[model samples]
Target: MASGISDAQLAVFVLSLRRSNPPSDTSIVLFMDSVSPRAREIMEAHAVEGVVFDKSKFGDIHPSTYRWPMITEAVEGRGAAVGNVLVADIRDMAFQGDPFEVIGREGGGLHVFTGVEHITLGKDGWNGGWVRDCFGERLLESIKDEVIICSGVSVGDRDNMVGYLKMMSSEMDLPSFKQCERNGVDQGVHNVLVHTGRLKGGGVDVKVHRQGGGTVANMQAGVAKYRRGEGVVNGEGRMVDVVHQYDRDGELQDHLFREFVEWDMAVEGVGEGGCEGYIIKENTEAYKGICDLSHDPGSDYLECCKVCNGKPNCRGFTHIRKGCWLKTCGNNGNKELKVVGATGAWKV
Candidate 1:
């Protein structure tokens, strides 16, 4: 299934990035292997470069049937000379500052730096210092393996990323992967590769940043001595570009994101063609379809949306009978009604 984030959040992110990062010859690229029906329409309407599985490349089957392998394929022959391949899984990002400037090119090496709660790290609860102060080492170790990574947003040179990408395509579990609903398995392989010293060939670095101390840091900020390593995940050397509040729910996250979007809008207005400028039609024939799928034979609105399979920039969707509503997301529901309401003269 596609991620549960709404299209509005995505629109805000793209818009924010356009203004924050501005642009250069560096063509910011956003890639997705499989795009849902209406979601594709929405993103395309916005003018974002959206890629779906090329049938010539995919054939008639669930694209996810070959997820890891295919995603690894998409990364191929792409990131070589791009300004900076700042890749973000659809659900794995929040654009705080200009990611273009913040996320360095892979030339420096493979690195993932995101702010996760300091309470969680490795197998043990907290290292000797932070959590130890709270519960001591013995108690912390008791809950080892119970932790989850918040978001280790990595950055790197990505020169030979194709190499590892290819390897993963071959090594990633296939049909048998149904039984492997484990952690981010692909990233697990990546972690193993980096820690074991496998990605140093064409020069890519992998680094992570976990939340431990009080404040976030930028390159010039006071990070730890070891975190400054060329490829250290959970490093403290720099202020994070985005903080993933993964703990929150969908609606609440939207509320929080509004502050961010409004801040950006205030700072620099809507970006010229930054977001995939989309508008939804209200009272169109589409709503009847939404009412059908929404309360339909299978009330799993989310699952139906999942069956649709959305990708990056392919923001939120509403499944219906005859057709689906692709764009029109801002807050709780479709934005057309709210937009009309604000107009006052258009109300029924």
Candidate 2:
């Protein structure tokens, strides 16, 4: 279940999942917000193969918290007919194999994924801050050495997943948790539940699977091994079933975009070559329609600039959130705009 995911990204996730698992053996229900016409088309195309899209709304609550209750309600509606369940982020995830293969038909345990080795929750700045913000420093210190368990993905049997979601939904209902509108605060709550034995008390058999040790790979943490088409693999060298945060690697993200979503880099005007000799400016962006080429979304600033350099008469570029606007300039160079999380570069 996800909100604000682009149509391109939705295609990648749903198509890849359908590709790996036959509809006869698997059922897919996607809970989404504001489904566009194109998104409806994509979902409808797969509806015959057991893909169901349910438009969801949770008012103004942050998606991280609202998704839990919504998911819980959806699963509970299925009653005894529901089987295994895999809760995952849609925008940045893709499947390379049958995700349920490892869990099996009688999925009995709540399986969660952790980051790669050596990146403990306490040691990481962003994750650590999330813990401190939500649970206070004392609670964080108790499990400071624990590896980061990403809340974005998890799999279990219907009962176990529903149980875990119930715990999460009830906790997020508290006044304190409701005030945490920021994204990623759920991670703190999730870790607290697992390490403090709260989940176990709720009848959830939590099983922690480290990166490369399980069916899922947290790409942001790092992967020990990866295959070109297969993505991250385990210590045993088998291809992982699901890959999360794959956008961290620009090349691999592009590969999946092209293969699964049919993202046409050539049509998008992305080309090779570094931004050598190009001036670098911090926190700048080019205004729209300044370039011959349209804006292109990439993984980072360097990739944006590289796309600019690859185009003809490209004089400058503005970048933010993996988007690049290649710009053409007059003899005086392009005018700069001040935007946070945005960068602009130009040549004299």
Give the winner by lDDT: 2
Task: List TM-score per model, in order.
Answer: 0.48, 0.75
Tell me the lDDT of model 1 at 162: 52
What residue runs in model 2 are displaced by over 4 Å at the alpha carbon?
48-60, 105-107, 263-318, 322-348
Top of the candidates by TM-score: 2
lDDT of 2 by residue, 42-156 (tens): 7777762222333344456677777788789878998988888888888789888877776774357898888656677798887778777777899889988988888999898
- Tens-digit lDDT track of model 1 for 39-94: 45555544566544454564443333345455455555454555345545444244
Give the TM-score (vs. native) of candidate 2. Answer: 0.75
Candidate 2, overall lDDT? 0.73
lDDT measured at residue 275 in model 1 versus the true structure, 0 to 100: 25
Give Cα-based local distance difference scores for all models. 0.38, 0.73
Q: Which stretches of candidate 1 lie over 4 Å from their true place?
A: 1-5, 23-46, 54-68, 102-107, 114-152, 173-183, 200-203, 212-239, 245-252, 256-348
**Model 2 alpha-carbon miss at residue 202, Å:** 1.6
RMSD of each: 14.1, 8.3
The alpha-carbon lDDT assigned to residue 99 of candidate 1 equals 50
